[model samples]
Target: MSTLPTLICLHGGFHGPGYWGPLVSLLADKGFRSITPHLLFGGTDKPIQSLEPVIEQVAKLVAEETSKGKDVVMINHSFGSFAGCSAIKGFTSKDPSKLSDQNSGKALGIITISGFFPEHEVSLAAMAAASRTARGAPDPATAPQLPFKPTEEGLLEYDGDPVHSFYNDLPLQEAQKWAAELENMSQFVFATGGGVYAGWMDVPVWYLLCEADNMMELPQQQSYVKKARDSGGDVTTREIDAGHSPMLSRPVEVAKFVQEAVASFSR
Candidate 1:
């Protein structure tokens, strides 16, 4: 009997594991076992301030699941995609040959939903700078000013209107509820790069582009998709008419595509 792949979900900035609740529940009904880990940056109880530790944590989780003889399909949203890709890179680098061997460190594929695709050694800060430059805006020395303010400890807190930036398609009450549950995130995570290994090149990658995303503009998303495809990534793309937080606005459709990705691996 073929073992079904495990879906490992990583949420975006200011979001904990709870952010994946809707999609996880839907995937569960379809017989998919999904694990949503609260990243160190967004932990309600304890938040870590660095990116390396977060990547290590994710890699450790993947290793633990693969050691149990289960294939992993990493699903990432927004900034979480950077951590997910970094984790995959770390896992594959430990045993490059095992990437093709399903029994050892089994990583089936990666699904990036409205996520950033950073180039090798390119930090998120740099990507943000480039985005601003593309729009003919002045480049700032520090991290780009966000809609939210950072606390005295340098943790980012979302203070902007979620309805406009994230859950534009979601109901007002539902969007407000989720927005209120968001936690503080470490600024370090966004400033760091994916390092040497470009994991997307080695694994099958599916990019879900949210066409109506306000946070990540449509053109910016397309640029990332192009970068992945041009760099020899086995890329597949599907565009949805939704905002940045599709899990809140279109959970069923998001889960359907994720299920399709898992099915492709088995075939």
Candidate 2:
């Protein structure tokens, strides 16, 4: 609300904004405004994870912050990248709103911690294709033997654990804490409609890739990053030598990378 750069952090599946707790404190220590709104999918006991509800929650938070005169720079993790894109497009765009211009000149840029960027119109067809063509498949932590059948108990296993798959790189305590607060994750957030979907903001884009990410192989993460660049989005990419969850495994280094990204945006 101080007309300063407000960094919005979005966590991925089976995780909440609490995952951003350390980084938020780090950012704030440096005179930045960092926010982590709870995503709806992380804390529920239900087996299904829908993206729409959480998307709405995030959009509302961003809009509220913006209305209070804060410029938002969204930093999304894994699946969170896709969710944030959808939420912003819906909340802050003008007519024919295919893109978000959140804080190009007014605030920092949109930084993706490493996730998918989708097409607009929210098409399942496109999302399905991406999944099939996904460079590195995102295997369900516990895929049902029946293929289409997912277990409610299996859902509870992950929801109850406190550390999602990608965050396997973190220390035990940190991982569990993150997983415990997670709620719902809809199957829809993964879809990619064939429509012309653009971010509702013009904030510059930065993708931080974990060179050793097991969940999304480096090639796959690179593929998505390349797509973002090709789409005329201003994107900068950096690779780290850690597993998928660099924030937990390498918090200090992650913070340093973010600091650099923020400075780059200022220029």
Q: Pick the candidate with the highest lDDT.
A: 1
Q: Candidate 2 — number of clashing residue pairs? A: 27
| Residue-level lDDT tens digits of model 1 in 150-256 | 67777777877766888888889988888777788876677776442466776788889999999888888898888778877888999999999888788999999
Give per-residue CA lDDT, model 2, range 20-128, as digits (tens).
7777777777787777776665555563344566667766766666555565677888867755776665433233232235342233466777676766665433664
Prediction-by-prediction clash tally? 0, 27
Q: Please give the lDDT score for candidate 2.
A: 0.63
State candidate 1's TM-score.
0.88
- Stretches of candidate 2 off by over 4 Å are 1-3, 45-50, 90-108, 123-125, 131-149, 152-164, 171-184, 191-197
Task: Give the least accurate 10-residue stretch of model 2, judged by summed lDDT.
Answer: 143-152
